[model samples]
Target chain A: MRKQWLKWLLPVLAFLVAFGLGRLDSRLYRQPIGQVIAVKTVKSVKTVDNFDNQDRTTTQEATVRFLNTSRRGQTTTITNQFTYSGTVDSPLRRGTQVFLTKSSGPWRLSNFKRDAIVLALAAFTLALLMLIVRKRLWFISASIAVNAILFTLATHIQTDASRPLVWVLFSGLAIVFAVVTALFVVGWRPVCAVVVGGTVGATALAVGLGYAIFALTGYRDLHLEAVKYVTQSPQLLFFIQIVIGSLGAVLDECSDIAISIMQLDGSGKKRFNAGMAIGRNVMGPLITVLFMIFIAETFAEAVLWLRNGNAIDQTISWVMGLGFAQSLISGFGIVIAIPLTSLLATLAGKKEVAA
Target chain B: MTTLSALALTLLVLMLAVGGKQGLSDAFALLLNAGLMILAVILIAGGFAPLAVAAVIGLIVLAVTIFLSTTDMNVAGPAFVASLLVMTGVIAVVVVGVLFSHTGGFGAEDTEDLEGFSLTVGVSFQQVLIATGLLSTLGAIAEAATAVAAGLIELGDDATAAGRQDIAQAIIGTALNTLFFGFFGGFSALFIWFAKLRYPFWEVLNDQIFAGELIQVLFSVIAVAATVPMTMWVVGRRHREEG
Candidate 1:
């Protein structure tokens, strides 16, 4: 009875703590650089239709109340124009909460109540996780939160550094992340061997294979359009993504292969053949799933191109090319990790026997 | 051949060499699944409702990938049901989160790419976001469900004395490790992209593209957590009946 109460209470407590942290984080970073105000729309004055009446841009007069800085609680009327299609710009309705930016000139609509909504969604997601997994929710949520913090810090450090430093920093961060995560999830066991082995081995293989593919293709098909805003080298960014993205699947595969081999080892069975069979069984489905993830990420873009009647080859080059390369690289990492992990587990088992 | 084609061919050869007939069949299923996704995309672009199209495509992909890849109906049937259930749950969470966040539509960075394209192209970007989220998550959900089901079934076959709880515990351990590490590694580049451009913390969190991808990851995590129990139940029940 008490245990049941704790299960429910713990998630609620965690949710409140997470919410508090989120608010504090926002407050610390919510800069007073510009006049930021929470505003509500007053009235819609007129509408101008453009591009054959397909797009309607509406002009609205809104009452804005400042949320931060010196003009807090000050209300003023500002005219804002936005597209009717809630795609490019958010369509405003009366009483809708939005952020207004006041610079040297007139105040303009910046974004809707996006931050509040995200926080709310995150809180709900946490609660949902707690309800589902009960005790394990803490570990999952804490790991994600910690990883997020580490990632943020790493990004900050990378951005402030130079080219080579950025690469070294991120690569080091990946290794650290892998080691820390392994410790947290599996503890000091044979599982840790598999996790670390698979993660490190897969990351190394991915980097090597990715570079080889790039060299072989003479770097002709590398997609640079997605990272135009990136101040750093796009090639480096691509490499970083491949290394990181391959981690999860590789770790997952490693766990599967390693665990299966451990089971065989415990039974004093033919470990090598069993490991090979498990590897063969896992590789196909794993590859298909990873490739599908890559495909799905690009699906919308591909559809947009197809809608525009673009040729299949052109669409493939622009939309699918880079994503495919990344997925393939990750898939290779996972496939290789299977055998590497099995070997690691087998060795660990032998060591146990010797002891 | 282009680098992608060369890579595909190379993967095919490697899989065939290593995995043999199973690898060949898996390769064929992947091709078919890719075709189905393309067909779904074409349908959506041709004005079909994005959600309906995504659902159909997801189901077909799950079937082809899980059923064709695995030989036994006992394993495939349970995996199929578990994946479908988890996929549905993921889609629900994503759809609700997306609708509330309104994290749909083009980003500020997308302006350069949209120079010639009309914003009034009449396609609902909101629906597009939903479809994209659903589609992106399907692979992870399917993979997790299939892994759990397959792992549990395999364990049951090998160790009849192992209870359902042991199997469940094993899968959950594997699932958590995979997912947490996966998120950390997979999203590193995207985070770096946001940082290199110096997108403010608030803006980074609020950006539609970033939010969409993050939501997809969260939904996948949820699906994985849900899948473990579901797979255990199915496989455990089967074991009991067989016993």
Candidate 2:
């Protein structure tokens, strides 16, 4: 009980701390700490690299004027220079809310201070609430702490999205250890089993995925980006990050649902059946939710591609090459979670042999 | 035809798998939510104070849905409160997201593709952006409400059957992660996609479309975060009241 209270208390403290840090960061950056009333994109100029590659190198230069409603509609205009990465030409127009920091003498752009606060607050609130309602506050808190670290690590990576192979390995190992530590702090035996099981399962899945990627695209030497700020094998770290990125929720779910089933089955039942049933119920619903989460995100992009009247081959290529990779990999984690948690619950229950 | 066929099959499979009754309920919920969201898009586009209307309708749906769904009224009641409170936070974040910073353009960031499509489709640029920002966050909010409501009920059910409040609390925590990961996973995939696509850092950050998407993402995150704790507080207080 006290442990649960501490879970809530810690997040509240963290919220307060993050709140303080955000304010400090805002002050340090001298960014506008005001509300935005209206955002307008005035002009867009697309610079092309070459007429031959004109289809590819269209860069958009947008002039955005923002009214800082947070401080009684203090207004500023910032020209956001960017490229048309999406298959389209122009981007959004005037009147959207965007966080901005001082870019030059008068302009501002978005950064960590403005963005992180909302994320931090949301994470803190959810973790705190889940703890209060479920009494698994500790586990939730540990997940948040690890997620925060990963968020930081993601920000710290200097390169583009793709990491070098070596860094991915080290980071994956590091993530496993960090998450294991967190699990140990919450419910050790169960968490340990989940970590081990999930890791083994994920590894098997990754190898299969890597080979599949190899066979399908046949473009093995594509210039994968390494972590930008950190000098390491970002690819290895990328995979690890995915593992770390994915593990917390699954682990949390596995431990959480497992424990709930144990408790629900009462102190008298043989417990194995209870564990199994809990796994069954939780796994099915979670799979549905996870599927929606992944599928919806990719669906939007896929829709856009198809809407453009692209060839079926081209659409499939896009989905297979990019959008679905992480989702498919994560799907493996979701499936593995079922058996992993169930098995762990069975094993953990054994320790209390005479109960 | 292919898309329709796939969707029909998927729905049919889901209906079979989850049981006809529960599956029907969930399907109804999705349709209702999607319809309301589309209506919200129109309303917000018609310049009806998007944030305010979104809040009222979102809260109402959350309240009405939980009340209607649950067998035990008390459980539904608190979940509703949590949903509202968290929703409040989400709205505030989104509103502040657009109005707080000096970055220009409509909607949150990452709607670059949408912006172009809107232009092609002959939709007004502002309308498209507003709809995007408003609609994008709706899924997150609805998902949170569903999870909180479900969590409360599940905990309550567990508590009643087993008589261990601690276990109920544990279940709630687990469910919260379920909600968190379920939502965040979707966003992270996109975020990583942007990174891999090598959208120029400065331009991507500075782009008005990107700005709109960022605001939407940030607001949804805030909403999810707020919903969790607020749900706890409201549910706890309501539980106390009932006791």
Candidate 3:
């Protein structure tokens, strides 16, 4: 009956997600900033494919809905007719700010796409709920979401956000807090065990991954340039992202194997040896999947290089070098994370079983 | 042979060793999927209707490759049906999103950055968009098939076979998480890169190539979501039939 309820709950959940986003959007639009005062539907004619052949105009027409929000009402509707060499899609509506000026009137319509924000929110909500509803799946989403959200929030901290060093230092602390909270809530470990062990494991993993990326990237002058786009401090933030990124997968893997082993061993003292054996079994396949995923995604670039008839050396230089190096580094994190997380969970689970 | 060639050869050997005769068929499926992507670019460049043509060809090729490769016609039929259904669902969502976002038209940025290369290969923005939308969803489809196939195969692993419906239900749970993790590991890096770079959000959307990538990723997620339910339905029906 519980399962059936959850089954039928899908539509209700969908409605909630949609309504939540729509309400949020409507509220945001109602802010003092801009309210739609008028709307106009645009009708215009245009040619779509002018380069290939001149014979057809394509005769495209659509209602270009415009909105005016300012008190002055001086804004003009944004229209394709003014900017394009070809015929317009429709007559520009007076309220259509989508491509027209939102001001009182007479200015050129610069940009007009308004529906993207609503769509993004909807997509995000759907993505979140899809991964969030399942029992085990919730843990994965919680770990990633909490960490990401907290990381982003930390950016607003005056001390932490001001400098990369402070950011990493504080974030390192946040990760410890996050992991402990996650483990305690999801795994139901004692608070002390969750906090202390999470801190130790997260710190060790973060520092270790940092060393790995730096060593692999060769610490050449390129690090600075790469840091601009990738991380504030490539060396430090690389460590942080990997530490957070691997947390969910690693913790999930450990808990999964450990719980199963514990159930198999039931009512007896937890068997460390048996737990290790289970980890060993899961480790091989887990690592294989992690490795294959990273490698396979790069397959397109490989194919592109091959098709271009690029020499092997040239191909690696252009197509594979950076992506490959990053993959190896991340793969290593995935590999090491399994054991680290497994060992920690085993110890924790063992204590519970014995108690 | 070069290192990559060596690596490719090794992958082939591993696939064959592990998957045996199934590996050959898997190879055919992979080739067909990749070929569809290329053919999409070609068709769109030739000014054919990109979506309609690619959809037809993609469906035909996928169906033929999967059916020919499997002994279990029951599994192939439903899995193929599920894949197409999932693809349709994903496309509908994308079209709706495009409409609401009011994000239409190709960006000059894509042309400036990749147009030369695309032209050299006879590919266009339209073709690239179609290829990306279709191919991005392939991983989920393949995962769905493998899950169903493995489930049904396990029922007769030895002399004895389990209840078909029971096995399908169990397999559905396993496959759902596997597909998620598979996508997780592959897409995480790109996700982090985009976030870390803090590229202006509007700029990324305005650039058609990046927009294409975003669309592909979103569609792929939708594909997985749609596939899970459809796969379960198909497998359930097949199990009932066999029973």
- Which run of 10 residues does model 2 chain B get worst, by summed lDDT? B118-127
Displacement of residue B39 (Cα, Å) in model 2 is 11
Q: What is the TM-score of each predicted model, taking all chains together?
A: 0.84, 0.54, 0.56
Measured with C-alpha atoms, the lDDT of residue B207 in candidate 1 is 74
lDDT by residue for model 2 over A139-220, one digit each (tens)? 6567656764565356345334444543553456445544544464355654455445644554455435544554555533
Whole-structure CA lDDT of model 3: 0.43
Model-by-model lDDT, in order? 0.67, 0.45, 0.43
Runs off by more than 4 Å, candidate 2: A1-191, A195-246, A261-270, A280-332, A351-355, B1-89, B102-221, B225-243
Give a tens-digit lDDT track for model 2, residues B126-188: 323333344444444444544555565566734452333443454444444544444443344
Residues A182-295, candidate 1: write the lDDT tens digits.
776677786686778777987697668767766787767656566433556877767777777667666666666766676664543467557767777777666665666666
DockQ for model 1? Answer: 0.45
Best of the two (1, 3) by TM-score: 1
The residue-by-residue lDDT of candidate 1 on B1-243, one tens digit each, is 567766677667766766789878877887787688778777876778888888888898888888877888878888888888777776776777677666667767666666665565455667877887777666656666676777676665665434544555555555555555544444566677787677876777767667666666666666666676677677777778889
lDDT of 3 by residue, B22-74 (tens): 55554455445435544543444354654676567657655754564555666
lDDT of 3 by residue, A243-344 (tens): 443443344444544454445544333554454444433332333323333333333343333334445545443444433333334334333433454455
